[model samples]
Target: MRQLLYQLIFFILLGIPDGRCLHMVNFFVPEFANRGDKVILECGFSVNDREEELYTVKWYKFDSRGKMSNFYTWTHSNQQPKKHRIEGVKVVMRESNQNFVTLKQMKIGSSGTYKCEVTSKRRNRNPKYFHPNENPPRFNVIEEEAKLQVVELAREPPEIQGGRGNYFYGDDLNLNCTSKPTYPPTTLTWFINDNRVGNSLIEDDLLYKDDDLYVTISFLRISVQPNLFRAGEIKVRCVAEITEEPIKASMLPDKKEFKLYQVKLPEAMKLSTQTIFDVPLFGDGCTNKLTKFILVIILFLNFMF
Candidate 1:
């Protein structure tokens, strides 16, 4: 009894008649689909009264700007389906009928609200078969609508740039994370030692590609501190995510590590002010051979003296 009451309330909410005449039974539309995929839209109905007969079925689409257009239609008298030419919508006539329509190679522009209208007619009780003055049949129409979103996913995980083999304390670390081209660019996040980093330490950018695709890039910068290291290393991770309706796609985080070493010097002997310089080492060339020769001569002269 409770289920029946719920059904009645649902019908009332949808403004559908509760009688056994002509009514919609079910409607199916995919909530999400990947780009370059084939999609099918279905509409089902039932007619219980013998006097009522199916009249016409039509499909319409609403774009992002809320513009409506009819894409397909089928009439019961002709028993043939008709397709209207529309950008980003390719109808497969061989696979389409009064009940369903097939879209081939759906693209990003295909993301929109789709509506199906079903119409039925009730025959006149006092119908004159050959009289031109008879009144037209009464038509009852029912419609249902749903939204679809088409998305393109990245082909590979995010790549990290500007990483070094090692790091020193009190140094500034700057890195960049980049994601491949995809529709509706991905969001990037940074982590250090399994802890999320604050937004102040990160910067984001997007590069537009052809066909409504984009590349996402994120930059991370932070000062190195002793507490940021664990087991003599610092771990960095970057995750790329795409959020869409009814589904979400994410790739495995890209990870990197930098070795950290402490300066081994006595506190008392360490200078209060020091200037560190990076000196280049000489290779095993003519200069090195000349130095070796001079060293040998000095040793011989010292022995003779």
Candidate 2:
């Protein structure tokens, strides 16, 4: 009898071939987390047979040697929080369907490998090593692990600055929009008179880190159109935004430069006039024959008188 018990123990401790469980479970974990936010790691399992067999969950962390150190456990509708845990880290079982562990107030040090394990509960009947509610018989075991990343938020908005120049029609227009160093990088979009710039235009964005923050600078380069530039400088606005952030980016003038030109009248388009053949002007040396004849008649009449 003792030899048979020893053989059973050897098979149980040594595990089956490949040491992998037959059941499968999916894990829902974020690739990264924002600082000061809640990070929820979920373990999802679907029982195709609709079996409601009692199950227990345990969450652990793997060391550099790939060894698991248990930090939290769930049994009998209760959970145990992790040891050496950061502030606000706890295990929460919502809907009694799956396992979920929430890490609160995440920081840079919170980055690490985390694992979730689930198993079916069974009664340990042996009297010599009998225990209640601890290390119950486990079957159909499944495990999943992931690496968590944390990032800080950047609160400042981006600044858009336009180059100083007396912009004229057909002149090259240049504008620069610089963003404050921030996490997750900032996005800068160029607009002219509320119209968005297209990808085919001369525009580009550059990013660099300043200390621990990320800064982005977007530049606009395009030849000014005649109708787009007018009496004054064109109003080109630089808008900056972060995709994950809830707040809107700082506003730059949404200005467009329209070109203006003077219109001239052609000679063919002027008013038409009629021609005059005998137009006379005073002090001209032209002979007045009628005036001489009248003067001779007047002298003869005077002599007869």
Candidate 3:
């Protein structure tokens, strides 16, 4: 009776529930990653007793839609790791092992929750913990999971349309700004003379594309004023960016800005008129009509005299 009580006390002290021997020690997974980047996922575990041996290690993934599937597995008996074919998951064989995996060229579709499962089994019975009359589970499994987010940034700068020409006072300025297709769609903002425009003057549109990407478009409409022009030109800027918490301090947000200059209507009209009238009409086989008429009259007088 005293030996059974001691064994119960020992089990309680060790906090071993349901004869589980494998314990997760550490799990390392990056929360954010850019597209086409390489990432490493690591799992560390320990067994409660020396008689327990590692049986197998498996890695599973749950996509954004909560569909679960196994991607990789390693068994102690085989001493080799095997990879399963899955879309958007490229495992580097030379860099992966039983405890960690290296994934290269990550894609936006790789965003999901990843689980690491470790299983262990007892090869021999421990005299102190195991009794002939008591039955225990042969295998124990422990699992840990982490979420990862993969993003694709815009490749080009923002584009501004419909604001290319000159603007006059009291005329309505209508412009549209568009950003390249990217994951987690970019945000478009409008600025006039360095002043940010409010939502009332802006209209937003989003276009969905293949591979879970989006193209963002924004429209700006406001009445042109003399104060908007500085030094005979108006500065119109459109900025596109992705707003999210940075995973690293050195990682900056993806941003692109495009600016266009619109000349004042009067300045543009003056330039147009100068371009039209600046050429001499009397050059190269052309002469002043008044001078020609005077010369003809003088010749006529000379002939009469």
Candidate 4:
């Protein structure tokens, strides 16, 4: 019986192949996290079908300066690090699973490279005396390092309702500037001819609206002559601050900057006489009436001549 036991122990200590002993490990979280936001750090092993002996998983963090230090060390025992050692950080490990560790409530300080180390045991001739594996030993496990990134939350852009339309002189032009749903909402200002309009000038203004999230809208109106079109070079712009630039980069199939649309007068207009030609009617009722009126005026003048 003793000989049988000794043979079994010899095989476990020296028989297992060396090359397959320790597997590589790596960690990954979302590429970005806002400050004071929740982030998850996952630590896992590269080896598939690893023996149950691999239980201990250690997770550590490094500072922005690239200095690495221990943050979390977990084992089957219920003991955990003192609250003072790891502030604003929490970890949960599952023994029921293959020893997966999840770190949460991440802060800016939590940003850094994280590593997981696992240790397994090899049975010896003496079961209780079973020694920790030495050849493919405690130090022989895989190491995977993943970098954590922290970012600031982005502010929402203000909303611009309705677009610029043709208006004759002395016509009431009502313009509204509304703020869109934003994280850390902001106030809006209405501008006419590059001048800020006062609250008294606003025809209808409500500084705040009742909604789940914070929002505000301002409305302003002014009467100006059509010739002021030069001044009404209207551009409604909404600006927001974000950690990421909103532009999406796409490569054009061809290298040329093509003009997709060119503004040209209609073919019929080109054929019309130079004397105050009427605009050719296209679609809808209101436009047809205007075109007919202009045509009648042109015909009347030609008849009188």
Question: In terms of lDDT, which candidate is strongest?
Answer: 1
Predicted structure with the largest TM-score when compared to the true one: 1
Which lDDT value does model 1 have at 37?
A: 93
The number of clashing residue pairs in each candidate reads 0, 14, 0, 0
Query: How high is each candidate's TM-score?
Result: 0.67, 0.42, 0.66, 0.42
Answer with 1 or 2, whichever has the higher lDDT.
Answer: 1
Per-residue lDDT of candidate 2, residues 192-224 (tens digit): 655677766645544434322356677777776
Please, what are the lDDT tens digits per residue for candidate 1 over residues 90-122? 999999998889999988788889999988887
lDDT per residue (tens digit) for residues 191-304 in model 3? 766678899999987665666566777888887665666665567778776633221111123333322112112221121000000111221113345667889999999999
- The C-alpha local distance difference test score for the whole of candidate 4 amounts to 0.46
Q: Candidate 4, residues 89-200: lDDT per residue as tens digits?
A: 5564442133355555555445556665565443233456554564333333555676655432324345555434444345455556555442223345555444455768
Q: What order do you get sorting by TM-score, best first?
A: 1, 3, 4, 2
Stretches > 4 Å off in candidate 3: 1-21, 126-137, 170-172, 230-233, 243-305
Better of 2 and 3 by TM-score: 3
Ranking the candidates on lDDT from highest down gives 1, 3, 2, 4
Error of 2 at 257 (Å): 40
**What lDDT score goes with residue 289 in model 2?**
49
Which lDDT value does model 3 have at 227? 64
Q: What is the model-wide C-alpha lDDT for candidate 1?
A: 0.73
